[model samples]
Target: MRLIQINKTYGDKTVLKDVTLDFPIGKVTVLVGPSGSGKSTILRSLNFLVTPESGQYDFNDHQIDFSQSISNKEKLAVRRETGMVFQDYNLFPHKTVLGNIIEGPTQVLKMGKKQAIKVAKELLAKVGLADYGDVYPSELSGGQAQRVAIARALAMKPRYVLLDEPTSALDPELELSVLKVLLQLAHEKQSMVLVTHNMAFAKQIADKIIFVENGEIIYDGDPKKFFSQDNSSKRIKNFIASMTMENLK
Candidate 1:
């Protein structure tokens, strides 16, 4: 999957400036940067949650030209190809965990109730929530609820999962559980693009890391090389130093 020269602006602010990226299949790609650096914007653009003002996006045979008129056909295709997990778990309050997972499959995919439930059960198990399928989101801990959100996203069997701070809502101790689920998914060779500020999570799960700031990409490379002490970018160096200090505190 690739973003071909995307450019987006909001009023006087240019949030994304001529950015282009290629995401490897079956690999985890992490986008790390400071707040308001356009990291989340990049993820949203990738998922077509918000179309960029100009550029082209290509994934397999799927393509969208933001410079031209977008068709509902392309929107549906992209929705099928990409799944997004937001900072907040957007589960339905009235639905049980199982119901939340099955809603899209049964309604959107047109799968039968029995088959959808079966698949939802499997997904619940995959996210380590097999026993909680009957429970409500409000009954689960923050970490647990986030795991269910991941399960809901997976039920679509999307080609790429786009996560925007999947662990941000949890404390350090609770964060480990959510991070573990993500690592497990990464091991299963799920193609993912993540927007996060959790440097530790990025280092643990990323095959590739890109640093974005001021609406532009400053660095893109292997995790080791990008995080190496000898890496010469002062901006990224300062970011690492600040995050390290914050972690210690």
Candidate 2:
């Protein structure tokens, strides 16, 4: 997926200005930045969840003008290929684990109940929650909830997944569960863009790291190069210093 000269503004204040970058498919690309740095906006814009004020988005073979009016069908079609995993699990309170995972496919995709349930079961097993299908979201730990969210998104068979601080709301141990599941997806050749503050995990699982400051990409290159840059901006260096393996250990 590619963003070309993208720009977004709220009234007179611009959030992202002329941002252009290419996210390689079939690899993990981590987007790192402090709060309100437009990292989340960039991710949201890809799905037209937050339409940009200007610029073009290039998907596998289609071009989308952020400024153009889009039909609901058009938008949902794009969204199907671009799944989002939020900081909160966003599971339905009344739905069981299996219900939550299969809801979208059965309801939105018009899939049969049995087919959706079959797929949901396979995904639950994939995320290491094979025995939790009958449980409700309220009964699961944060990590389990988040893993279910991942499975819910994956059930749609998205070509690219967008994650916004996936572990932010979890305790350290719970965070590991979510991270381990995502890390395994990297091995599966899942293409994803993750917005995270977990620098240690970024270095470990990301094939590329995009550093953003004040809404612009300051660095977009190999994850190792990001760590070794002597001339790295103070903002980036400071960000790195804040990350510790204490949580990972």
Candidate 3:
């Protein structure tokens, strides 16, 4: 999937300025930046959740022109290929874990209920939540709920899994659980685009890193170089130092 010359704004404030990015297949691409730097918007635009004012988005056989009015069908098609996991788990409060995971498969994919449930079970196990299928979102801890959310996203079998700060809402211990699932996915070569604040985790899992600041990309290359104190830009060095300090606190 690729975005070319993308530009987005809200009134007088420009969020993304001619941003072009590529998400390689079977690789984990991590987006790291300070707050309000347009990382989340870039993540959301993958599934058309946050439309840009102008640009081209190419995914598989679909090429979307953001300057034109997008049809609902076009939007749905893009979303079908991309699974989004937000900062918040966003699970259905009234639904059980099994129900939440199977909803998209059974409804949108038109899989049989039994088949959807079967696939959901496998995904739940993959995320280390095999026994929690009958449990409701309200009953699960922060980490458990996020795992279920991951399972729900996986059950769709999307081509690219887009995560917007998936572990940000949890404490460090709980964050580790979610990170483990993500690391496992990376090991299995699942293509993904992630927006995250965890520099340590980003260095560990990223195949490519894109650093954004003030809605512009400051760096887009090797994670090793991005994290290297001596090699990175002064701005990036300061940013990393600040983030590291914040993490220590």
Candidate 4:
């Protein structure tokens, strides 16, 4: 999937300025930047949750011109190809873990209920929640809930999984659990686009890294070189130092 010359704004504030990005298949692309740097906006745009006012979105056979009014069918079609996991987990409070995982497959994909449940159970096991299918969201811990959310996203069998601060809400111990699942996905070569503040996890899993600041990309290249500050600007160096310091605190 690719975004070309994308621009987005809210009133006088520009959020994304002519941003162009590519998400390659079977690779993990990590977006890292300071707060309010438009990383989340870029991630959301991947799933069509936040539409840019202008630019082109190319995914599979679909080429969307954001300058024109997009039809609901077009939006849904693009959305079905990507799964989004947000910081909040966003699980249905009234639904059990099994129900949440099967919701997309049974509703959107139109899979049979039995088949959906079967698939959901397998995904739950993949995320280390096989026994929690009958548990409700309210009963699970932060990490457990996030794992279920991951399973729910994977249940759709999306070509790419988009995650925005998936571990930001949890404590250090709980955060490790979510990161473990993500690392496993990386090893399995599941394509993912992630917006995160966790630099260590980013360095460990990213096949490519894009650094954004003030809604503009500062760096987009090799993670090893980017993290090593090789040929990087003073600004990039300072940002990394600051993030490292923050992590230490």
Candidate 5:
């Protein structure tokens, strides 16, 4: 998936300016930066959750242009290939875990209950929540709930799973369980775009890291070099210094 010449503006505030970057297939790209730098906006624009003022997006054979008006069929097609996991679990309060997971498959994809439930059960087990399918969202711990959310996203069998600060809502103690599941996904080579404040986890999982500030991409390259990376901007270097695990520890 690739985004080119992306631009966005909110009144006087220009959120994204001529942003272009490639998300290599089956690889994880982690976005990091100070709050309000528009990292999340970049993620949101990928599926047109927040459309860009102008840009071109290409994911496999599907290409979209924000420069022209887009139809609902185009929008639905983009959404069909992607899934998003939020900081808050975003599970339906009235629904059981299995109900939440199967909703997308049964309703949107027109899949039958037997197949959806069978797939849901396998995904639940993958997230280490096989037995919790019968339980309500309120009954699970923060980590467990987030795991269910991950499972819900995977139930769609999307090509890419976009996460916005998925671990941010969990307590420090509960973060590991969620991270463990993510690491497993990493091992299985799932493609993902993640916006996060957790530098340690970013360092661990990111194949590439993009640092943004003031609504522009300042750095876009390898994660291995990002920690010790010395780029053109001193301000970005300082920001990296502050967020690196060495400084945190």
Candidate 6:
């Protein structure tokens, strides 16, 4: 996806300001920055969850303006190729793991019930939650819950996966488990945009690291140079310092 001078505002508060960037295809890219720096806003804008005030978004060769009036059907078609996972699992309390994964495909995609269940079972195993399909979300650990969430997103067969603070709500142990799954996914599939504070993981797996500050991208390139000690930008340095301390503590 390509974003050209994307801009967004809420009343007088500008959440994203002329942010321009290209997400390399078939690679895992990381967006790292301070909280409320518009990383999440960029993700939301990509999926049109939040419309931008100005600029163009190019997806699969189609360029669209956020200000243009788009039909719900058109938006839904775009959603089919993009999957989003949030910090919260957002699974239904009343549904079984199996139920949650199959609901969308069977209902929205109009897949047969048996076919959806067949697909769900395979995804469950792939995510390492093969035995948890019959269980409720309440019975699973945070990591397991998040895995199911990821699997549910995958069940839709999206081309691009967008993650927002995926491990923030988990404990250390659970967080590690979830992070491992994310790494596995990144290695297994080539397309994903991860918005996270995990610098270590970004350094390890990201093809490119994007640094956003105060609703704009200050830098976008190799992780090593972006986080280097010689980098004298106060905003970038402060963000790296704070994340390092948080991880250390």
Better of 2 and 3 by TM-score: 3
How big is the RMSD of model 3? 1.4
Instruction: Count backbone clashes in candidate 3.
Output: 0
- Tell me how far candidate 5 lies from the true structure as C-alpha RMSD in angstroms: 1.7
Error at 221, model 4, angstroms:
0.9
Clashing pairs in 1: none
lDDT of 4 by residue, 1-249 (tens): 999999999899999999999889999999999899999999998888899999999999999999999999998998897999989999999999999999999899999999999999999999998899999999999999999999999999999999999999999999999999999999999999999988888989999999998889889888998888465488877788787785365
Give one digit per residue, the lDDT tens place, for model 3 in 193-224.
99999989999999999999889988999998
Model 6 alpha-carbon miss at residue 171, Å: 0.8
CA-lDDT, candidates in order: 0.90, 0.90, 0.92, 0.92, 0.90, 0.87
lDDT of 6 by residue, 138-173 (tens): 999889999999999889888888898999888888
**Candidate 1 lDDT, tens digit per residue, 1-249?**
999889999999999999999999999999998899998998998777888999999978977789998888888888887888987899999999999999989988899999999999998888888899899989999988999999999999999999999888889877888889999999999999998888878998999999999989999889997888998887788898887785366
Q: Give candidate 2's TM-score.
A: 0.94
In candidate 5, which residue pairs clash? none
Which structure is stronger by lDDT: 2 or 3?
A: 3
TM-score of each: 0.97, 0.94, 0.97, 0.97, 0.95, 0.94
Candidate 5 per-residue C-alpha lDDT over 141-222 given as tens digits, one digit per residue, 9 for 90 to 100: 9999999999999988888999999999899879999999998998899999999999889999999999988888988998
Q: What is the lDDT of candidate 6?
A: 0.87
* Pairwise TM-score winner, candidates 1 and 5: 1
Backbone clashes under 3 angstroms, per model: 0, 0, 0, 0, 0, 0
TM-score of 5: 0.95
lDDT of 2 at 188: 94
lDDT per residue for candidate 2 within 1-249, as digits (tens), equals 999999988888788989999999999999988788899999888888788878999997778887887678778888989888999989998999999999889888889999999999999999999999999999999999999999999998899999999999999999999999999999999999999988888989999999887879888998888986584577677677766543344
